[model samples]
Target chain A: MPNTLILSIDAMGGDHGPSVVIPAVDIAARQLGDVRFLLHGDQAQIEAELAKAPAARAASEIRHADKAIAMDEKPAQAMRRGKGSSVWNAVEAVKDGQAAAAVSAGNTGALMAISMLVLRMAEGIKRPAIVASWPTMNGISAVLDVGANVESDAEQLVEFAIMGAAFHHAVHGSTKPTVGLLNVGSEEQKGHEEVREAHALLRANSFDFDYRGFVEGNDIAKGTVDVIVTDGFTGNVALKTAEGLARFFGNELRATFKSGPLAMLGAVFASGALGAMRKRMDPGAVNGGPLLGLNGIVVKSHGGADAPGYAAAIRVAADLARSDFTAEIDRNIRRLGAVVSESAASPAEGAAE
Target chain B: MPNTLILSIDAMGGDHGPSVVIPAVDIAARQLGDVRFLLHGDQAQIEAELAKAPAARAASEIRHADKAIAMDEKPAQAMRRGKGSSVWNAVEAVKDGQAAAAVSAGNTGALMAISMLVLRMAEGIKRPAIVASWPTMNGISAVLDVGANVESDAEQLVEFAIMGAAFHHAVHGSTKPTVGLLNVGSEEQKGHEEVREAHALLRANSFDFDYRGFVEGNDIAKGTVDVIVTDGFTGNVALKTAEGLARFFGNELRATFKSGPLAMLGAVFASGALGAMRKRMDPGAVNGGPLLGLNGIVVKSHGGADAPGYAAAIRVAADLARSDFTAEIDRNIRRLGAVVSESAASPAEGAAE
Candidate 1:
């Protein structure tokens, strides 16, 4: 922790806890050199797992915690009684500047609540958004408000656009990431009030990011924009719907190959290509969702993710920690605040501004 | 018109127009026995196409219209000046009781606007919803408010539940379709005010449908319920997201098979099974979307759909017309009105009510 980047890990989080967390740290350590892990969990359990992974053991220091938050704990309950818990302490490390970012596989509600409480909102953000990397045909696009805020107004959606674009530029290294408001159609008159209002705001403002008006749901996979902005409810549904469909396609393909003798024989010859396709479609390849708008960085891994998947989350955390993500967000948010104030002064400026 | 079930065709509606519509009517004629077609469009063009399709020629009677609505025409503009248009007349046939339903391979906006204006709302519906058949692992499920009302209140969502369940029963023959309200999570406190309100309303009411608790996006493909009720915005996004993902999967699979000689050879061996799988995944197989809550039935086919797809739309309209769909909807809507009145009378009934 002398001069290296430190990442706080909730070792007792998720289903497998230290068993998966330790190995994940080992994997991430190889990829992310000069990074130290501040592990928060039961000392004996973590030490036992860390012993098996020499790479992780060399770069990790244990910060023992008395309790681990349950996966099914309500957000409010977790916030009220989760002090000194593994998840709480892991996020606390980030707040205390002992770690640049915190990575957790605990329940989303608990993690979001604890992270918000410990890290607090960035300068002007009312509600923090969870941004996920959406794998598209042309690489990955950033989709924000995945499940953080249930509903977002026009102002919040615009904030998401700014934050999402900054995150994309920081993590994915897009020079000038184009942002789009998710709507039913690209038409100006389409969609509901909030989306329409967001569209107006995005178009009116000369934000740092390129605003690409409105885009439909199909455009998410088409890679029409670098960042897709939407309310948490719609974004969450879109993300899960795509996941469900992908799984359905995989299940259907497997069942098709197993249906007949010819298909099975074909499967043998096509196994290499099919395996490549499976790899491309694998959720583990991009398993992290960064909780954006928080003062300190926090990356959340899927509860069911394997070591590689958890490592992916760790890498996302590392990317945000290394980049000027927080500063970029602050600059854009300040710009947004100015634009909003100007619009407020002038009634005829724009409907949403 | 004389004892035979009549379907009005918008001959000049879609991209292909009469070329697709005539053949579609011919194909539907063979399947839907004792059904007559009241064709509305350019009489000369429809006659030429109908001559090529003997089944359609025998069943259909041409009703010439001077104009056809442009595919890109705005809904308000279309409604203002589209009186004698083919789409207008096709819907008019339904209103006049000359046709059991109207099937159009037209622009959705124009169709929805024209249908609403001509047919008007049913006894109690404030806004009509567009219901689509979603292909699921367990047969097909009904998802509604696909793109009708972008912002639906709690009352509207409950209406979607009743209407969707009725439509599912009418067309798919589900005795009591299980209905689920689309939300971010299953928890009682999850999602926005509207979704939570809708969930409470659905849970409290004893509609004809079986009301399951709130469901997430993944449950859609898993076929957790027979019908999923959501606002047009979320439903539309979910539908298109799934479509985009499915298309992405298909494109990936095609690319995988074409990557190398061995993969191509494997594809050749697996062609039969793959073709079957392709059929299962085909959007054309489930092309039609019925605009529910209207006084008369109106089925809209995909604008780019071919003959088979248009035939599917016709079949949907026929199934809806032949059943007690309207009566069922009326009964359920009446019951809903009563329930709302009772809940309004009792202040402490439920949060949504």
Candidate 2:
């Protein structure tokens, strides 16, 4: 008998809460066989949504949480009053070995806070970074440190690259996945000193992934590397900007077609082609990205993700949990700590103060 | 006689040298009626290219230079050996009051270096910033500090906002262009201290542009503001990322349409609409953007730009020269300096060391 991969769900987290989560859980279960869910939230509301998703209802064992964390609450506030909340309880399930992984589309700060507090950090990893599944010309590449650390030093950046590489290997099944440090310019002399230090360290440290040195902003979409690493601040801006540009490009293209009667005629004939393009660019297709370097796998969906998009997130979480992803990352990070023993000096070098 | 706007041209700059620059000058001369050029380069080579453009020859007077800066040359190298080089001489023309603006497709770092040395910094501006005229959903908006300085304090960011607003007003003809600080998050508590301090300063200062506070990367394409300001490090990465994403999006869409016979037929019908979009999204359509916060105007074209794109750069140089853009920026930056009186305390607050 195949081992059952169980994922905990924070059904009360996202904008739509249980409504989106229940259907997503059903879709994920259908896509990924041999899976069970430990759902944490308001029992009555979850059961109502689960009633509509018969598959999810059968696979999930619902647990009642008396309260839900508000989206606006800070990390400190969540730590103070968020125990027994859906997200907190869900994370605790993972820590308690009742669930293999946790998935949330809730308040990012609150989620990160509660997860770190409950699950604890991976033994060797200093800070965990959020990952983004970026759409590339060839396929998809994982970009991380999206917003976990607003500021990162060389060591943290190096750790992000390590975690990203491990996650990519787990998700994409690439043995020697290539990694690159994202910079303003590809030249060795370009960018801040810490970026240079990270580049040097990755090159010299005999890292797990194929370190492709420096890559620029354009490299992110070109799929120049399998995993791109940067500080959370730059990564967040890049991820959101790319999202904005793709939408902007599509809107502008549609407007061009609607400009005249001749264009309208062309639109009808080309509806098949345009439809294919639309499907390829759909956010729902690649909505779920793992938050790597954590003790347990946690996938985050876009805040406004619908059922289909949330399903994509759940699929990622379930897939990661099933694989030996946690053990793989833990082993790699431990090896990384031994190889780059200079992690002690790096934080001081990159600190702004 | 309409007052002629004299633009100093570095004819030896860019990949194609005089071949691209001479024809571009001709196009600009025709596009803007009251324009004359002070072309700087090897006389024989420039005149040979000028022979193909009768209109350009009529409008230009060749001024020979003995040296030329290589594309890969560093800024420090340019300062030492670039004197009397085409780019250097071109900037000298602006400083000597022979031309109102200088246009180059030369090395970005070298161009800024030579321009700064000759033109000097404008009063009350610590560093000059490269401006990019971004194509938005509504119209063009200006984003600045693209790559002049890798790190900037709150005062420099405020200065960029002031200069960006002036450029927007000069080009877009908006009396009070709205400005936003590019950040990872829009909330008050997000981002680094410099960003928060910059946010506080922009709100408190009586800036010429309407301050829109913090904006995320998505707001750039959303056209949330007329001017977007950030430290050069973030701005450069954001600008390049947007450009990269646009191309990636276009490439992916093309592949989608070419997937199968049905898609091909649909593509054939939608050719007209697609053609219209192709035209609207062409990089050549929006090529030139001013390098703001300088003593005199300087416009940098895409290094690989063909004749049409180079012509677009020349047009921008001529337009800014005639619009009193420098005086406007100078005046606004001066006012900005007076309004934000705490520049002394900012760098120390932001420094890591």
Candidate 3:
């Protein structure tokens, strides 16, 4: 028999709350074996939905939570009065050792803030980062620090590199991912001081992953590297900008195909191929964005994710929990700390000698 | 008879040099009335290409230059040794008042460097910004500082807003353009100190355009504003990211349409609509990127632009020359100086009282 794994889920989060959560858990339960869920939400609502999903009812243990944080609530406000809330308890289960991982589809800012507070930063990590899976020409590459810290220094960027690579290995099954530092140009002297400094650091050390020097914004979709590391501000803008362009193109393409009867007939004949392309580009296919650099595993699904999308997020959480993701982070972060300290001590040690 | 406007051309620049430049001028001569060209390059090559285009030959005067800067040359190297190169002569014509504006499909760095060294910055402008005409759902919006300034202070960002707004008005014919500061979020306190400060300044001032406060990266293609002002670093990344995604989606769509026999037939029938959509998204259609904050106008076309694309850049230079772009900038910049000075003096005057 496979080892039984317990997963905590915030059933009162996201746009549809229990309605989406119960159905999503059912999908996840059907796909993943020997996995049990600790569902935290309103008992009546969760039970009403779980009754319709017999598999989900059999695998889930309900923990009644009367309070549910609003999707638009401020991070600080959520922190102050979020005790006993479904999202809060779901994360708490991971910290309490009752669950191997926690998954939630809720307010991004509040979820990140809560995850940081509950799990705390992993040893030697100054800041936490959110990592997104970007679909590329070759395959999916991981992009990190998407929106955790708006501003990051050289060391923080290095930390992101370490955590992002480890997370990619766990979720995407890359044994040793190749990482890249995002900049305006591929040249060493192209970007600002912090990026330059991070480049120097990444070049000096020999980590588990290969550190490709520098990559531009276009390199993200070109699949130039397995892990693309950047400060949260630039990464966030790039992510949202790509999403916006995709929407714009989709709308324009639809209008083009509907312009004339000939175009409409062409679209009908091309429906099979077009449907396949849409599936490849679908956001739901790769829905999970794991909050990296925290002490415990927590995945944040898109707030508007469907049942299948939420299930995809659950699979990500399960994969991360089964792998040595935390240990990998701890080892790399320790190496980084040593490198920084060694550089710091080199001049002083030379003087004494 | 219309008033004659002269445009200086870097005929020895870009991939095709005189062959593309002469044909492009021919196209422009047919489209725009009362526009004369001063071609700067090797006289023999310019004359050879001019033989094929009678309209351009009649309207053009060749100013032969012995040298041309290499596209990959460093900015400083070009500045040191680029005295009588084709790009240098092109800008010098504008500086000497022989040409109202200059156009180059050459080295962006060398051209910008030469333009800055020769024409110099405008009276109140600190640094020059390159403004790109971005294709949007509603129409085109002008995005500025795409790769000119790596980092911008709050004041420089405001300068971009003033220059960018004036530019949109000049080129796109927006009588009262709307401007937005590109930020991580629309919330007042979302971004870093500089963006926040820039937002505050834009909101406080009553300028020639309507200040739309802050816009995220996605708002660019959505046509949320007429002018989107950003620091060069963020703007460059965003521009490249969008272009990369566009290429990615285009490739995927083509692959989908060519996957099977039915799809191939559909592609044939829908070719007209697809061709029209392609034209809308073509980079050549909006090929010009004007270098703003200079004493005279200078537009940079894509290095690999064909004849028609090069002509588009020429048309942009012609439009700016005919419009009161410089005067509009001067009016708003003087107002900005007064506002900055007033704010700087308010506390001092109050303390003295």
Best by lDDT: 1
Model 1 C-alpha RMSD to native? 2.5
Q: lDDT for each of the candidates? A: 0.87, 0.81, 0.86
lDDT of 1 by residue, A1-353 (tens): 46699999999888899999999999999999899999999999999998899999999999999999999998889999999999999999999989999999999989999999988998898888999898888788999888897788888999999889988998899989999999888877777777776777677778779998999888888889999999999998888877777777778888888988989888878979987786676433478889999989999999988999899999999989999888888888888888787776322232210
Off by over 4 Å in 1: A282-285, A345-353, B282-285, B345-353
Q: What docking grade does candidate 3 earn?
A: acceptable
Segments in model 2 whose C-alpha atoms lie over 4 Å from true places: A282-285, A339-353, B282-285, B340-353
- The CAPRI quality class of candidate 1 comes to medium
Model 2 chain A is weakest, by summed lDDT over 10 consecutive residues, at A344-353
Please tell me which predicted candidate would have the highest DockQ against the true structure: 1
TM-score, every prediction: 0.96, 0.94, 0.96
Candidate 2's docking class is medium
Writing each residue's lDDT as its tens digit, candidate 3 over A298-338 gives: 99988988888899999999999999899988999889998
- Write model 2 residue lDDT over B112-225, tens digit each, in one string: 888888888888889889888887776888888888877888878988988888888887777899999988888777788778888887876676679999998888878899
lDDT of 2 by residue, A1-353 (tens): 25888899999988889988899999987888888999999999998998899899889999899999988887889998999999999999988888888889888888888888887888888988988877677677888878887788887888898888877887777788899998878877788877888887787667667999989887887889999998888888887877777677778767866877766665666667676666565323478777677777777777778998898888778768767677767776776677577564442133110
Tell me the deviation in Å of residue A17 in model 3. 0.8
lDDT of 1 by residue, B22-121 (tens): 9999999999989999999999999999889999998989999999999898888899988999999999999998889999887988899999999999
Q: With candidate 3 superimposed using the best TM-score fit, by how many Å does residue B308's alpha carbon deviate from the native?
A: 0.6
What's the i-RMS of each model?
3.7, 4.2, 7.2
